[model samples]
Target: MPISRLSDLSDRALAPRLVIKVGSALLVGKEGARRRWLTALVAEIAEARARGQDVIVVSSGAIALGAATLGLEKGGRGSLADAQAAAAVGQIALSGLWAELLGSHGLTAAQMLLTLDDLEDRRRYLNVTATLTRLLDAGAVPVINENDSVATQEIRFGDNDRLAARVAQAAQASAVLLLSDIDGLYDRHPKEPGAQMIPVVEGVTREVHAMASTESNSGMGSGGMVSKLQAAEIAELAGICLVIGNGQHERPVARIIGEGIGTLFLPRRSASARKAWLGGRLRLKGSIHVDAGAAVALRRGSSLLAKGVTGVEGHFDRGDPVAIVDAEARVVAHGLSEYHAGECAAIRGLHSSEQAEVLGYSPRSSVVHRDQLVLK
Candidate 1:
């Protein structure tokens, strides 16, 4: 395909759900969190939220901020120990800033720290997705970062770019905007004379990979241009549009989409790789007790329908993780509950057709979807 122009985007529409990745290089400065930029970015996000669009931010900078707080060199992960300490110190400040910034726009911010293990483990990935769904349902913006303090090369994602892609896959988002210092992919080292910018990429080829600069332009960030391409590949496989854009502007997302000031990687026309039997671990808040017949049904990989539940234990709200136990109160499985403890109690043993009358709302047929359950 030929290069796309800004005029081509005039009549275009963006995806309903968008995931934005903000690298540490763009978010942190000598003073710590760049409030001015963050304020600008969050303001735009608040506006999008107001317009009824869902947005999730995958951010980096905890370790950088922690290093700054500890008076260490900026972005200096001199040793594994040093990086972990910096992340521990920085996460507190990062979370606080995220809360304060989004709160100004009357938006609640929830923090999620993840590692590669969180995404790869069959039991934990589901929990993360469920939590994200819950937060979005509550109209809160989730600020996610790698759990750097506890992350090691063996378990860590290593960079936010690819993590953002994983998040988009789990969220089933339509678009991913990778905000960076540079505008987008280029034909050669941008500094080289006559180097040209590529406006749109339909595929990732060896030729495309060769275009990536070997060195990270931003000395502070772990993700270089290469990682952005890697992220694009992931997004493409999931049928999610990925854009690499300069985020220094007031409303970078708008500029990227509207002005064509970024490189847009088109997703495959058909995306089937996005679907998989995902696993995850989430904080457990309650338990659901079921009859022996229901236990047998669940053991056969059936969903926990409302009619099977004998009782609910503890006080878990919607989207909270709960144990599914048998008559002996032995845990059969762990899964996210579709309804709150009260709701589950109110509808226990009731058929799906009978739930709306008792609950005053149409209830999910299954208290726990089979896909969300992990058999013990």
Candidate 2:
């Protein structure tokens, strides 16, 4: 069902694991950090935690804050080196502020700086997920930011909007809240005379994407309506609801959940269906060929063990999705490999007990764990 009005958001739907993306424009100002806005936002987060909802914040402002601190200008004129230096300096300030603000509310905050490699590499992806889960379990809010200090333009996500959507998927979040300069998506640019606010978007159709303005509204932020729409599409594919609203208001988080003052993008699939969709979208990076007995074991719901006598067929990194083929060369399943191709080549046909001795260290016994595998 589409949510065309504020009344459509119920308390039951509101209480879920939420990933909130805060833009640089809302969090930074001329002098420095916007303390008043952050204080209120932290209070809202604390209130949500009290209501038994786990919240993760994906924030953007390190570059802006750093640039402000160094008296450097914002925008395209800044060099890559300048941006990196600024991020290094600004991240400390950003994390420190979050810690202090949340501390006052009796909540602990954990800082996590991530690069694209962290999510794309299988081992690092699992590690990150585990760490975030542990932090949430321990009643701490995770404050995440892109590792801009080390990331190059070629590998960077560029905007936190897409990063937040990926984080929501990784954390298995039920909802995502994007706090932007504007209140919600509009049928046309809100500045236009006849533009209309769209309260609910069932899906990100081409029409919805076309509604986004080409130019960003905030000079401090990199993402515009187009990026938010892209994020909404990603969230929708993950079966996670996304809300885009104005962060300039007092108690913005509270208003979003309580009053539903935003454009809500409804999820089109269930969690299981979403997973299946993801499996389908992955391009096969490699293929692992298994013997008949191993194929039968796989069909019987066993994890793909190294002893299964697999032949690695391509160069791929750990966490890259690969096809699993039987003796007949028929593709039977697809999954994220626990080890890279070279590691698999060294340990193939080895017993679980011998994995540590062969590899010098055993990260895991299964080459492809059942949880990561999807049967055809």
Candidate 3:
């Protein structure tokens, strides 16, 4: 069902797992932390927890916080090394403050710093998701941030908005709320006269993207409205609803959730559809050719066991997506490989129990698990 009203969202039945993103501008000030705003935000989080919803926060502010602590001039372009050093210093203070503030509300906060590699690698992605799931189950609110200290331009996510979207996908969250400086997406730049707010977005069309082109002037944050729209697209494709709203007001989260004072992006696909989209989105790194019997087994929803694999083509690492082909060279499915191409080649046509003898140690019985496979 398409959610067109805020009343649909306030039901709580619609969103069980929620991921909220807080930009640096909302969390930091010229002097230091924004205590009153932080308190209200944490209070809202506590209220949500009391209502039995699992909430995760994706926060950004390390660089800005670090720069302030080091007495570095703000709004100045700095080198990558300088930014990294600031992040290293800021992460400690940022996480500490999060812990302290959440603690005051009697909620435990678990800090998680992640890099792009963590999500791109299947094994690492699973590990991160599992850890987050465990933390939520233990009643701990996981506060995640990008690992800016070690990230280079080539490896960084660039903004917490996209990171939050990826986290929503990995955690299988129901919704993602991006709290920024503006109340919501506007048809024109909000500062411009005659700008109109877009209350609901059923899908992120090219037209919707045009509204976000105005670069954000928020001194403490890197992302503008463009990044939030990008995140909305990601979240929508992952079967998660996304909301972009202002965080400067008291009880900002509550206002967004209860009053729906933001631009809401609805999920257009179902969970299975989203998974199929993901399976098809990645470029195939290699091919695993299987025998006739194995192909039939696959059709019957069986895992791709090592004994069934006849050949491994291309050099690819574990967790890389690979096409599963039949002997006729027809691709049947695609999935993340459990072993490197070289290791898979060595284990081809061997029984599951014989894997240890062939490779000295076997990581998994199946080359590609059924759960990971998406049939054409």
Best by lDDT: 3
User: Over 4 Å off in model 3, which ranges?
Assistant: 1-4, 7-10, 75-77, 271-376
lDDT of 1 by residue, 1-376 (tens): 3214433322214466778999887889877788888888898788778777788999999999999989776465988888999999999999999999999989999999998878766567778888998998999899999999999876777889989988887887767789988999999999999998998898667699999985667688888889898788767666677888998777777788767788888864434431322212223588999999999998897999999899889999887778889998777877778988998999999999999999998887689998777665
User: Residue 304 lDDT in model 1?
Assistant: 95
lDDT of 3 by residue, 178-290 (tens): 99988899998988999999998887776887777547768667788888887887677667888888898999987886877998888565446434334423346889999
TM-score of each: 0.70, 0.72, 0.74
True-structure lDDT of candidate 2: 0.81
Comparison by lDDT, 1 against 3, better one: 3
lDDT of each: 0.81, 0.81, 0.82
